[model samples]
Target: MEILLNLKNRICSLGIPLHAAFEDIGTDKTVELWSEIFLNCGQIMKEQRLDAGSAWKKVISENRGLLPLEQADWDSINDFGELLGKSDRLNQESVLDMARESIALLEKKAEEAMKTKGKLYRNLGALCGAAVVIVLI
Candidate 1:
């Protein structure tokens, strides 16, 4: 149970946009998928006798080629390493809080990106309108 919680916390802290994607898809579907993955992972850990650290290490080693988490997310990967180093000292609430903060930061970044894109579109439209007026003159 500790290993499973650790694994879940680590993954959540990565802030992979899964939760945001889940929100877009609908809460029920999100809950269902979460439950499925949780159960599957729990079973794997039990059957394989894989501790959380070993399981995560195996996943990175085996699926580095296929995992976005393994590539280009160095900061998060580093953060995970730090978390692992201190895992023995941290309480569950602290882990959850870290995950929540990561998710919030990602969501804020996504929103800001969307706002920037919207502003760019508006600027482009204004530029096009100016070009049309200049052509008419």
Candidate 2:
């Protein structure tokens, strides 16, 4: 469960840089930036070790610039990753458009997750954790 959450965060985290690179670095330059981003992602996974989620949050916070990633923006990121893996269109506009859509979707999701009703889910997590400990004992 935590792995999924962290992966969601990482995927959203990746879109932040990719979106910025598309806008700031321009289409012609993003290939290099994409490679660099992948490298940074691998390093994030490696360096975080046992505390990956928090460490990744910090790493992303430090590098995410002004683009705030919310809880709602997280769900579609795994789907986006799947599409990216199968996609063969490496052209500038194609990749840029995909990145743009991902950014928008993720941002929207984050906003939704912060809404009033979503607070209930926090207790559910605690319940699940307590169940696990009970099972262990």
> What are the per-model numbers of colliding residue pairs?
0, 7
Stretches > 4 Å off in candidate 2: 1-37, 41-90, 118-137
Tell me how candidate 1 scores on lDDT. Answer: 0.47
The sequence of per-residue lDDT tens digits that candidate 2 reaches over residues 1-137 is 22223333433444433333222322233355333433454454445442333433444445544334444443333233333322332442354366566666665655776774576678788889999999999
Q: Runs in model 1 with CA error above 4 Å?
A: 1-28, 31-40, 53-90
Candidate number of the best TM-score = 1
Best candidate according to lDDT:
1
lDDT of each: 0.47, 0.43
Q: State how far residue 71 of model 1 sits from its true place (Å).
A: 7.6
Measure candidate 2: CA RMSD: 14.6
Clashes of 1: 0
What TM-score would you give candidate 2 relative to the actual structure?
A: 0.28
